[model samples]
Target: MFLTNTLIVLATVAGMEAFAWLAHKYVMHGWGWGWHASHHAPRSGWFEANDLYALVFAALAIVLIALGTSGRWPLQWIGAGMTLYGALYFVAHDGLVHQRWPWRWVPRSGYLKRLYQAHRLHHAVHGREGCVSFGFLWAPSPTRLRAQLQAAQAQRRAQPRQAPPQRPPQADTRGR
Candidate 1:
């Protein structure tokens, strides 16, 4: 029973992870670009709009859990899988990959380096090269990822920064 449960959970997680990647590549970066823009903008904040994607996933988990608990085995497994995916994403993307929190050491592997490079490229200049690397936790090649990063950096350097708009001063109502 334990092994069966584990398999179900693993399969669910893998499927959800794939869906998450697709959503990011298409929805978030494509039609939803306006909502995702704050993530690419330079700002002084601890969190970015990219974080909202996690919330959406969490809400999905809640709905899945509801369906699963209501006598639906498939839905339950799907929920379990989504939760696992979210956990893995938090570890791999936020913890290990981005190092949002400090860790004493990180493992040096070609695979991990590749994932890092690919994600860095995604953040590079926001949407120049599409579909080179899309996985959240794993990457197949570091060399290709590095090339993508270099290209993104070059593209960013070639672009000029835009100035912010100034607002007109208003009358002081406090004096009245």
Candidate 2:
């Protein structure tokens, strides 16, 4: 039963990870641009719509747990796997990749670098369109990723800045 549970959890986690990648590429970066846009905006805000995706996933977990309690071992295992994956994603994406908190050691693996590069590509643009690198963990090559990141940064810098809109003259409230 333990082995079966382990296998089920592993498979479910893998599926969930893949689904996350696809959703990031399509939904989050595509149709869901309204929420995710805050992430790319120059100035930071107190709340971002991108967080709703996490909330939705958490709600899904709660539902899965409720359903799994009724003699559904497979479902329970899958739920466990998803919860684990979320935790891992938080640690990897928010913690390691983004450096939201202060941790000094950088990931040394080539694969991890690739994943970072992919994420960098995702952040390279402000709108819904760009190269998609949605996986929370796993990058295949660091050098290539670094190159891509540099290129994207250069491209962004090369774009011309727009001037502020002109305002119409207003009547004075007080006359001399």
Q: lDDT of model 2 at residue 93?
A: 75
In terms of lDDT, model 1 sits at 0.73
State each model's C-alpha RMSD to the native. Answer: 7.1, 5.7
TM-score for each predicted model, relative to the true structure: 0.71, 0.73
Model 2 TM-score on a 0 to 1 scale? 0.73
Poorest stretch of ten by lDDT in candidate 1: 124-133
lDDT of each: 0.73, 0.73
Q: Among all windows of ten consecutive residues in candidate 2, which has the lowest summed lDDT?
A: 137-146
